[model samples]
Target chain A: MDDVLRQGVEIRLTVNGRKHREVVEPRLLLADFLRQRLGLTGTHLGCEQGVCGSCTVVVDGETMRSCLLFAAQMDGSGVETIEGLADDPDRLHPVQQAFWDHHGLQCGFCTPGMVLTAKALLEENPEPSGAEIREALAGNICRCTGYVFIVDSVKAAAETMASNAPRGESP
Target chain B: MKPAAFAYCAPRTLEEAISLLDEHGYDAKLLAGGQSLVPLMNLRLARPTVLVDINRVDGLAFVESGDEVVRIGAMTRHHTVATSSEIRGASPLLSHAAGHIGYRAIRHRGTLGGSLAHADPASELPCVAVTQSATVRVTGSAGERTIRADELFLAEMTTTLAPDEIVTSVAIPRIRPDEGWGFREFVRKVGDFAVVMAAALLRVADGRVASARLGLGGAEGTPRRVTEAEQALVGSVLGAETIEKAARVAAEAVEPTSDIHGSADYRRRLVHAMTRRALQDALGRLEAGHG
Candidate 1:
């Protein structure tokens, strides 16, 4: 086997549409890799375990648990966390604005995951009912409020985003 | 915390995976989704010298169903079954059970094959597999062999899989459109494991039960079929009274033990109640021709 120091694997990852080629330790989790190496800390980590959805990020267009995967495993995948959502100066993603307006978060640790979840939900369904939004966010655990505001935020985001949506299917 | 020190081998092909497993024998572990094994390794419950990572291996994550059977890949994630339109139409019971497994993230990474291989008494898939007469496909240095569901599991966290044998897929009989199926369980939290779970699959023909299969989890070391209860339902019409009587017999077949979740007697009673409800739901679905 190669030397342990050479355990830093050469991996190519596309984050937020920009690709980065770097050598990283196999032990570096995708969550930590994004935060520490790639300087994208918008993805939060609440429970290191997969319980809290705080570490959610989209890999290859599918929402996944970043904490559950190693950096080496996602070498060739396209990843999009909250950092990749919007660069447009004129408009903010609806899920972002909904959280800001509806007071969906208190501690703010779960906001990143909440926003990603909302983004995923709205992308798949332009008009999600309240129950559907709640069910979509079941993986995200918020210890602050009883999830009333979170559900409301998702519902409002769905409505607001639907009004200004592009006619094409989700990419 | 990181898992204990172990050599990791990331094989890019199935042949390489088998070669590694064959060489390392019992000391090598297959890391597919790592949903269960990673946690167990982190807790030091399972310490192995080598980990043969198969996440990079291709073509093992899928499900294929024929007229009478559905073959699900070993590396197929739980969410795959839960959201599969084909599986929902073919075997709603499997989809329903997969939907109730943990949360979305957990479901995204956890594999049906992993759950069955782990063989936890409280898990949903094993119990459902036993009830539905699924078959497990295993590959090893000896090529491959299929083990019937009843012979696959022997004890808690145990299976008939040889140390060098890797489970490739599970084969389930395709349910007829009018066949009845149900799974019911109680959980303390959204993603928590079940306290006790029960599964029922009844084949009804001409307004009478043709055959029935029943199984329970968290009530024994391994998921067990309630032969006595099944006998009660086979020749009778699928009705409230008959369903209730079958449930009573199903409860009598269990020797549940008390845990922090519930007492033995309480669990037995819950099993009976859930069995009754599930049978009713199954029959209702069959009569309505719901897939």
Candidate 2:
């Protein structure tokens, strides 16, 4: 057996474009590493189980369920959360801005993950169709707004991002 | 739901993974995406003293398409398989089933090899593997071998995998151009485990069925091939009587066990209705020339 696991292990993860290294238990989930270890609690943990997507984050530009990955699994990996999307104080990621403008959230428990999922989706496809948007965010479950506003927000964001991008570039 | 304390080892090579599994035997468990395993661990339903994390094992994340077989690496993410153009061309049924597993988050992290090895009767991948005639490749210290998909799954949440072995890849053989595929499941939610699921792949040649394969999940302790149904589908045309007979045979072959999601009788009904619908869907695809 590894000695570090018996004691603890040093886990280094790049989150929101920044590098973070810490010692955590083997059972520490990636969600807790962002929330408890790094004080980035914006990423909510609704269902500790994998059903709800509230704990979703982008790992190496791919969306993953943070609750399902152990912190150690992300060693030397790049993690992007909801906080990483907005660099400027006044500006949000197109997906995030679209959510606010379109009233995409009510209780807001599912917003961060929804925005992250949308950002990841639009990053790959700038002009996603309605059905594509539905499929892209199918993992995210929202209680309020009946998911109409959220889907609309992803569509609006996709359009805005599409219009903003240069030709021949991926969304 | 915090899991109990345990040792975790992220072996960097497949050799090390096999060695660790051999050393610990049943005391250790291989941790993949942790989508299914973590839930069990959190509930203390499964508590192992050691966890062999093979996420970093090199060359275990790929989708390989040979001239006739499409081999997916054991650790390949479901998202990768779902979006794989190669898989779309080679075995679209697998790509479709992978997409239908849970949701995006789960798909992004979950693995096909791990899911098939887990052999959960309610999961879609096992049924898909069986329906499509996939071959599961197992690697251990002894040697590498392959198990027919229909023979891979043993029981609920169990498989024929030895404690010392690791599932390395799943090879899905090519589908004839004339074959069509369809899958149907009755789950409470979009991503919930199925109460009853049926998948079909059949080839219509010479105005008659040339080959037929099916996998029924949640209808048996293990996802199994419906030999009785296959016998009926053979040499039949895409007609009402053929479908009815095949559906009845498929339903009768079912050895369903009841649970909270449904009763045995309800599942039996689903077996017939779902089999009929899935067969119709595959037939429609054949007619459209989109196989």
Candidate 3:
């Protein structure tokens, strides 16, 4: 029992292209660790249970609910948060810029997660249909903007990314 | 809401995980995808003093097709099952049911073993396993063993697994070449738990139903294989009359409880309708050359 139990676990992981090492309590969620310990607050926490997708982060290339995962579980995994989306500080990622152009956010609580989800969707599917976009973002809940604008924003982002791709690389 | 403070141990091997479980007994809960268990912990519905994290366990996340079964590792994610070509080719019913689990993020992180071990009556995978007659393999300090799906689930959110046992994998019998399947559920929202769900498989030979399997979820304390309904379809030609009779039998086969989402009577009606629709759907697939 002594070997199996620990007061705190030390985790070493990469977040948004940066390596981090921290010792955290076993119950501290990954969402809180990113916001409090690392001071990356772009990841929002809504409905700390797994219901809301506001705390979604790309862990090992798959979007997962950060609120449900303990910080200790991310020992060696690579995580991507909304803060890492931009290729440059002066420009937003195509997904984020599309949201800005199309008015995809209102109260802004669900924007970061919605943007990251759309980014993953477009990265995998450069030309997603309206229904496909809706299905991809269904886990994320938005109380404002009525979701019509978000769908349009994802569509716009897909178009921008397809056009930006180099000739034969475009899908 | 936050989970209570607890000790966490990430075991890199199955043997080590079993040993940890042996030491902690009921005080520890194995963490798979953490989609279900963490939510319960956050809400304070579950308060284990130790969490044995098995995500790092090697050789526990795979999908393989063998002579008679499609073997899925317990740690296989729902998204992987939903998207796997092998699973779709071997057992289209299981593949289709996996797609109906929670939304994309949940599917990306939730594991089939976690869902089955949780044994939520309203969940899709347990009912699919019961209808498909799958087998779950478990390991404990006493070594490894297998339990049939029918005997695995004992009650609501409870299974026959001992406290020190850990489910290792699930083996689903490959769908026979002559079988057709259908799955249907009535949910208020796309990701909400099913009010009543049905999965039906029919084996046709000589224009008659050679065998049938029917299962209903969210209609009782545990997902049940509706033998009476299945028996009503065997040897029949699957005509409208036979389908209606089986639907009625399915509606009468279980005693459902009323919750805020629905009444027992309403669920019974859903069972009848879903059964009829599922039978029709199965027949359509058979006619469309699912064989």
Quote each prediction's TM-score: 0.92, 0.94, 0.96
**A31-130 per-residue lDDT for model 3 (tens digits):** 9999999999999999998777899999999888999999999999999999998978789999999999999999999998999889988988999999
Is candidate 2 or 3 superior in TM-score? 3
**Candidate order by decreasing DockQ:** 3, 2, 1
Displacement of residue A101 (Cα, Å) in model 1 is 0.5
Q: How many angstroms is the interface RMSD of candidate 3?
A: 2.0
Candidate 2 on B205-258: residue-level lDDT in tens? Answer: 789998888778888888888989998999877777898899998888887899
Note the DockQ of each predicted structure.
Answer: 0.34, 0.55, 0.65
**lDDT for A110 (candidate 3):** 94
Name model 1 segments beyond 4 Å from true.
A1-6, A88-90, A167-171
Can you rank all candidates by TM-score, best first? Answer: 3, 2, 1
Q: List per-candidate RMSD values in Å.
A: 2.9, 2.5, 2.0
Q: Summarize candidate 1's per-residue lDDT along B1-291 as a digit string, tens digits.
A: 555556667888888899999998888888877777766765567767677888888888888978888889989989899999877777789899998888776787889888888898888889888988899998888889999988999998999988778888998888777677888887776667888888888888777899888888888788889999989999898899999999999888888878788899998998898788888878887877743
lDDT of each: 0.83, 0.85, 0.91
- Residue B110, model 2: lDDT of 88
Clashing pairs in 2: A123-A171
